[model samples]
Target: MKVLIAMDSFKGSLSSKQGSEAIAAGIKEVYPSADTKMLPLADGGEGTVEALVEATKGTLFTVPVIGPLQEKIEATYGVLGDHRTVVIEVAAACGLPLIREEQRNPLIATTFGVGELINDAIERGYRDFIIGLGGSATNDGGVGMLQALGFQFQDRHGKEIELGGQSLKDIRRIDAENVSPALSEAQFNVACDVTNPLYGETGAAYIFGPQKGATPEMVEELDQGLRNFARIASEDLGKDIQNPPGAGAAGGLGAAFIGFLQGELKSGIELILESVKMEEQIKGVDIVVTGEGKLDGQTSMGKTASGVAQLAKKMGVPAIALAGSITEEAADLNEIGITSYFSILTKPMTLNEAIDPDTARQNLQVTTAQLFRLIKAFKQ
Candidate 1:
């Protein structure tokens, strides 16, 4: 029998590759002659660079860049096996975790490091880009990033505006004349999962600003700043970018990508799956196994497991999910493509015990063995 195992990371316990290997070990215990293929999976978020790099045997590069609050920091990016595509996660540069709780102020944060990473990759001759837009620490309408890339946002006095959200209202001109010339030859496929617009009630500032340490008053100021930036961009750049589905993602970085770079925003899961060419990897597999740290209603909403199961279903393959924990809402996953779902725990334990890497590995192997044992018996 042939099995394809593709599992997302189990959070702090196991990585996607390790989780798939554990499942493969279990299947081997049941049928020593079985063939299994392991594929690591992620949904274009925290683990995206690691997952894609591992899956494609890519190389990782680290560079020094400016952080959200003008501090210097080290950031990492990846080059896929193809050698032409570069993957960058916004979180690496200016994520919320980079700052202390008391210092989380969106108005003063910046995404300048993100543009620096992209510029570095371009210098290396990489023209294809897959950018993950998650866990940002800014609401500057991407002005900082644009500035780093040589897109000048100038005040009425013809001087470049200062960086960060607080400076958005001072912009009276947008200039791309000095942009990195190589940028025009590049293509960006942005991984964005949210649909918030650039500025209003459901937009970047009103919805995500508070989470970045904005008070009620700060949120209002940031929203107005975004509105001003959008209007100026429309008049100067000839693009109305504030109303797109994902324009608010990564605190208006999404708008910058769309308006200036001509990037396409897509579902995170969909983008990652396409990047990995998952359908080609699953062909002729007898059964597919996929899961994550947890399975719940949210798992059905374009997460890694749901994305895998949906593809397997379209190819006439049965998909089984194995997770660390399963909630009542996980039952809804059955309607999507999961033939069945199983929790890897065998007995009650503390959260710490459950997440122990060795313990989780053993449970995954044992559970997989038992399930395959039944399948073998029925086949006979």
Candidate 2:
């Protein structure tokens, strides 16, 4: 029998790759001759660069860039060995973790570091870019990124606007004359899973600003700032991206990608699946084992587990899930064509106890051993 193990990181516990290895060890204990394949997956949030590089053996490039706060920070992005594709995660540059807990302020953060990475890759002669829009610490509507790309946002008097989200309130004229000339021949692809619009009730400010250390009043002000930005962009570019899906992602960096960078937004999971050649890998496999940190209603929403199960079902392969803990309300997964499910632990445990990856891996070994035994006897 052939089994494919594709799982995301088990939260703080094992990485998807480590979890796959643990699963393979357990499976081998029962079926010594079974063929097992591991494909660790990432969802464009955190860990995207590591997953992509590990899977494709890509080369990593490090550079010093301006962080969200215009502070100097060392950032990393990836270049596939194929030489034409450059992979980047915005988190690596100006991510929330780059700032202290007390320093978290969306209105003050920026995506300028992200643009720096893009510019670096462009200078290296790469024409295709895959950027992950997650873990931002800013809400500048990609203004900093625009600044880096040479789309100067000048005040009515022609002075350039200041950095970060707060300055978005400055009314502006946009000048693209200094923008990168190679953009005409390049392609930008944004891999993300959010569906929020650029501004308003479901927009970036109202939904995510709080987590970035905003007070209720700040949320309102940030929302207004984003709205004003939308108006200016529409008037200047003659385009409406106010409600574009994923535009709220990475603090409106999604809109920047669409408007200034001309990038296509794609679901993070779908992009990973395609990146790993999962469609062909799942074919003829007896079982497709996929998982994540938790399984719940959200897991049904194009998550890695759901994406894997749906594709496996299409190819007539049975799919199963193995999660660190089965967050309640996971019943929806049954409706998504997952043939069965498994939680790593057999006994109840606290969230921390259950996810301490070493404990989880040991529990996984025992649980998977039993699962394979049951399947083995049933088949016999």
Q: lDDT tens digits, residues 216-299, model 1?
A: 999999999999999999998789879888999989999999998999999999999998899998899999999999999899
Best by TM-score: 1
Overall lDDT per candidate, in order of appearance: 0.93, 0.85
**Model 2: per-residue Cα lDDT over 1-380, one tens digit each:** 99998878786788878887888888999999999988888887787777777766789999999997889999999887567788899989889888898989877788888888988989989989888898898888988988887888878789998888887888577778998788767798789889999999999999989888888988888888888888988898875767789999988999888877778999988887787788898987899888887888889886889988989988988888888767668987887878888888879888888878788899878888889999999999
Error of 1 at 54 (Å): 0.6
Give lDDT: candidate 2, residue 288. 87
* Per-model TM against the reference: 0.96, 0.95
| Runs off by more than 4 Å, candidate 2 | none
In candidate 1, position 88 carries an lDDT of 96
In model 2, the Cα lDDT at residue 124 comes to 89
Q: How many Å off is the CA of 354 in candidate 2?
A: 1.6
Candidate 1 Cα lDDT to native: 0.93
